[model samples]
Target: MALSTNRSPQDTLKIAQVRSANVDGTWAIANKAGIAYSHDPVLGVSVVSKSDWGRLAEELSSSEFKMVKIDSVAASYGALQVWSVQTPRFDNARAQRRHSGLGAIWAVYSDEKSSVPDIQDFTEPVDAVYTWVDSSDPDWQTSYSQFKNSVPAAGSHPTSRDIARYTSRDELKYSLRSLEMNMPWIRQIYLVTAGQTPKWLDTSNTKIKVIDHAEIFESPEDCLPTFNSHAIETQISRISGLSEHFIYVNDDIFFGRPMSPNVFFTGSGSVKYSLAKAHYAEASNPRLAVNLAAKLNAELIEAKYGKTTARKFKHVAHPQRRSIHKLINKAFSAEVQETAKHKFRHVNDVSVPSALAHYVAAAEGVGVPADIDYAYVDLGGNHLPMNLYRLVRGRGMQMFCLNEVASVSENEKRGQLAKRVLDDLFPYKSSFEK
Candidate 1:
């Protein structure tokens, strides 16, 4: 974990004096004046300082810190100060702990521990793939109506929200252009959609391929009029010319900086999974299919595999092996088939892409457990501008996502803000463009 600050070392001490900042493992983050700040940057750590604020930091990490939950504040200085915020902690130890379990699986299989090689240094080309859709497209809007009667009138699967799971703010095209400009080694770019393409996209580019949903869906009965991501995701392996190794991203996701294959796969030819522990005793949101999918992944890993991991994969483009996904689909055909039929997100959906296939690759001695640093902003966020700044600014953010897209009826100012940042980041035209 690397820690960076815009302020000089002397200024860092003046503000709060991060004495013996512990960023070795998991890091931390908190909202201050609507700005997001992650601590020295790692897992579970307390910034020990000689200042009075040091005590406040310790108290906030302790069990008695209830100011954030109740939306109240407490002060101890002459000047009355009010602060109420719930901090988000990062724990890398839990992820590291799984290495032993993964190692045992690998150890029983083979051995090669000489020099560590960076896979990115290799010349083998890797492709970037994305599943994008524009909600406002008349064809798509009409398609949504085709299955409107199947969905309930109201609930978590709301008509106004679920009807447009795939929002097209032109983020995908910008993100694709960023991939072309930043990652020099990034090979063919694949755009998978529900039979829709961005108008701004250059279809004439041979380097780009627009894959239709009808081409990859397993069965004809479950192919058309499909609104389920699980069904769509499960069929990515079936893509005609998809590389043996590729990164799958949603239209909302992007590559913040140039990345090498080594960032994803280790020198040992093993794929890396960016995962976080998100196990729960029981799920409350029944309609949250991604959670259900993660739970399903956990259960599958525990039952068939030799280890137990309650980890959940974040919403980022992940390095996926074509064969590994095929194996996962074969091993869990029934679940995959059921997941495919969901016209919209449902509780029964399985998210094997998150952890299942990656975990299986590890069990078979071709996977690595890794942590990822990425910025994420929901369009509906009040501090979206700040989050977007944190994402594109010179903070060296590598990957990011802009989800929960605003409808046409909603304000387009958010879209403008995001575009401004992207335009500043990648101002040149990519070869993939006309």
Candidate 2:
């Protein structure tokens, strides 16, 4: 990864918007932050009917509107629910189903990727999709079928879908190949997984490196597996590949719509913010670990209580505000917190790798008060305990750019009610084509 020499402070004054229809709460948070957010009603409609999503797929395949998939939204759809009761008009109400004026604003502007006529042109309202890049074939539907045959036994694994749903080799290969060929905005690619590898990877160009359970840590739990698989491993592997400070992307992320890398890069001490997702409250740790050596400005220093002259110092002088705890948390782990404090407080100049090492040391039962600095951070939804702890500790506050997209269940038909509502937000590109 190439580091960006154009490190300028991000412009906080600019009016940035994100498309996050499935995550109404995230949109509400963005609105509170004064950022405009839109969500694809089409996705909502599709969740309510598959035919709608099929229509969207048809339009995208035709390149009608320079479509892009709002993948993060799709990834989070399982946790969201459309209330049966009519949603009341309230500022705090979720963007997905509310019926007030602001809700109307969201409804009018949000749209499926293929319906926005100027989506291909960034000069218009900004639009984008996330993708997991790799070098493989463009069509993996065949692999999707093969994956069904290879699923493990049901007793060992508990999933909503049969094991066959995940064993799609063709789909994985096709998706990875698209990443290799289409996404030019990327500077580096990191593949994080504890699952099976896609067969396409065997023959494709190695632009992206894969980091599975074996490569990242000794065990999944030790690695805090509940956190985003890509977030931890990619952050570690791609730190060295920081070509102009690259962006972290998920496997499903794809830019079917038009937008530029400039959308994410703003010359601010690299933009950092939690991505849009479901949120919940958890116990917060005030004494969480921040950069120490960067905090102390010295290479070596004796611990406040220990006899050691000086521990090994690491990294440059800069305070990072993020924490590993933000990634995972255990409700009643005060001992863990004490241990983290001992390590982070006393350690000198901790780099990301060194920090991981420290965590390893603490995990191995070599610390006190049970790591006080190991407080829980938010992980959106999913494994609440895991997200409550591990965090993506970083140098400063993060900036965000969202695409108001919707997430649909795998079994749900796409683009019926959600698409109709989305059409109300943005006219179909066919209007312009006509």
Candidate 3:
């Protein structure tokens, strides 16, 4: 049946079932309410029991109200590991840190693997897990292998070992194992892959829902964009099933520690913004790069029909280098000279979603944020300046975990992981609750 374009007026909704749970009774309720159902198979999870899964499949097949919202948390959780070139530490400290912030968390993966870490000991209770499996084609293997063996080409900062370590299926296995161990805490697991759902995940007590990836994300858009939109839409769609808020996470970074949900939801702003840091700059000529980046990025601005376009931007350009001190002085003056009114709000206040919308809209000649009003935080994890720059340009936090007190790897030479409590604490904004 087609999804309802109109929104439901009801504010409160019931979770009929999420995975391998007693489906018969719940469907009885769903049937009475004339609601839809959903599940994810690839990640080995279901919201209903085996009998209920069968019943749901048949009922959904014949019923017009089979529309249900599926959470792809597991898929996303795994995908993080599958896609990234890094290994995450699985410990209690990191797990608690993540749990307390966002009420829900999911794993994402780009491919399959044999072994994974055991995370039941680290993480808090979960609302759901999401798993994503790419296509069955052989080429995915080739790409995965290449990514596993390859290091960042020259000029890249993350180092060869970091990249190589996370490229293999074994690494993914370890991560998955960790995630699987956390299953009991998860309310449901969404598998975004094709083919049959794994059998071991099904049970008479849990509920399992399996549907094609296309069902969650309709085509006409590419994968990344589709994932972004579906990520939001899928949650919004689950008005009757999920809580008001959920979480999105990358998989390569494991739950090496314990976490509390209170930290993330503690603040009471109309909106909460967070992002990973991409890059940093300490130039003597602040106006030069900012102005240049802005100008180059300005192609995104739209000129209203028959409206006049002004030469609104200006900055200094030099051919020869003076002393660093002289450069700093000139740059500082230029930056001050440029009025706040002339610059884009994104330069001062921004977040990941807004940043993406800005540039994406910019590509289409739409207006960018010249003035923004919102709370923002940085989420930093990258090995290169360009990656960091792109992440910043994309609206991610520039220094998210920089001050984290308890991290997965403390070598300083190794990658960063989510922070934990008691282990260490990063200096959070005052707005964040203690």
Candidate 4:
């Protein structure tokens, strides 16, 4: 049979290896055809001779395997075409390159060694940090109600206290599943919460650590019962044992396909920040909490560097550095402290990891702009059903976010629809789950 198109790039490579091994064992192509090659998990195979490459291609096609030419290169020795062998399940599947580097399917060579230059892969350890809260928990709700009631209604943004923002439709469970399936290279995961853990999560997983709010906050007494995500995100760098390079993820964001560490970090360990086309500086609603935070961040950037921050960042996993965050804390000490002390989302707060840190890192020359195939699905929007359908059927995005802007009257209906889509997207249980 042919390789399934739905399989991930890593799984496709494994299947290719198995098929190659079978051809070597049964046909004895290496001995009869006189070919020398080496193979690895990253780069599939390297063929040294052109005649042997022709023979191998013939054997693979004759054995009922499908092959498509993905990329080609011309060298002084000869012309080479990279072949990816997989059954195309969709009309446009042939156009898609499964991996970032050379074909995971197979590649022919004209020289003694691989002519393709390495893609600057790094070996540094990377971690993931997620800020989550279980709003349904009695103790958490008690604190949330107490603090939420204390805030005055006159000056707060309309959607700042929206309950839809805190409602968890078990997105974290599937998000972790997506991470485990696609980004297996992550070294560790720190789940920051308000003294509540999901019942389905397996705390025994060594790769995951459940962090409490009191543990990371500089002043636990001041920030302990806070429901503000901005306040909590300000303390993410304070997570004990966090890696030098880490990705800050919100529970609503999910990895859609196989991803490499290079997607988030460069070979030299510089962070790659995904920028959106929307400019926060030109935003119409400055009264919105998120917009106000972006405007505040732009002010800081402009005051320090004299250059205006225009574009906003995508709503995906934010790649960050601990040292850079420390630098930001030192540079904007008062702003950082002010954000941390706010019990609720205030107009004066700055989005630290998502917005401010990216700008500061860019100014210091440690961060570079990158592009990702990202999708943002707003749950409160009218096209929720269509968006979810497209997200699942396409399966081409690198990352996606299911964001709820405000608490609608039909919260239960929308929650059910979103959960159904998530379950369809990821039905298999991850190791982090019991």
Give the winner by lDDT: 4
Estimate TM-scores for all models. Answer: 0.67, 0.28, 0.28, 0.78
For residue 397, give model 1's deviation from the true position in Å: 1.1
What tens-digit string does per-residue lDDT give for candidate 4 at 1-434?
23344855333433223334433442354456555655433323343446567777776556544555543321112225555443233213433333211123345666565544444654578999999989888887777787688867554556667766788888999789777645666889999998888998889989999999999999988767787899999999999999999999999998765566777887787889999888776777767787899989988888889998888889999999899899888888899898888777888888999989898988998899998889999888887889988876773467899988776546678878888777656545677877
Predicted structure 3: lDDT: 0.27
lDDT of 2 by residue, 1-434 (tens): 11122332111110011111223433333345444333433222123123333343343334321222232222122312221111121112232221111111211222332333222221111111122322233333334334334433232112212322222212223223223222233434555544334443542435455554345442333333221222242233223333333344423222222112223322232222221121111114212133332233122112222222123322111111122322212321232232222211222223232233223223333211111111222112244333311211221111111111223334232323323322222111210011
Candidate 2 TM-score over all chains jointly? 0.28
The RMSD of every model to the true structure, in order and in angstroms, is 16.2, 20.1, 21.4, 6.1
In terms of TM-score, which candidate is strongest?
4
* Whole-model lDDT values for every prediction: 0.56, 0.26, 0.27, 0.72
Which regions in candidate 4 have their CA more than 4 angstroms from the true location?
1-111, 114-119, 151-155, 408-411
Off by over 4 Å in 3: 1-126, 129-131, 134-186, 194-211, 219-243, 267-277, 280-434
lDDT of 1 by residue, 146-198 (tens): 77766664332343345545666677766775565335455677888888877
The clash count of every prediction, one per candidate, is 7, 93, 98, 0
lDDT of 2: 0.26
Ranking by lDDT: 4, 1, 3, 2
For 1-434, candidate 3 gives per-residue lDDT tens digits of 12122443111111111111223433454466554433333333223323334444455435432222222332232223210001111113332232212111222322333223233211222333233434233554454455434523332222212322222221222223333322333344343333334333332334324444445432213322121211322222222343223333222323322122221222220112232233213334434323333332233223212221222211100001112112222333232222111211123211112222223322334222221111121223344334333322332211121221123243533333222211122111111011
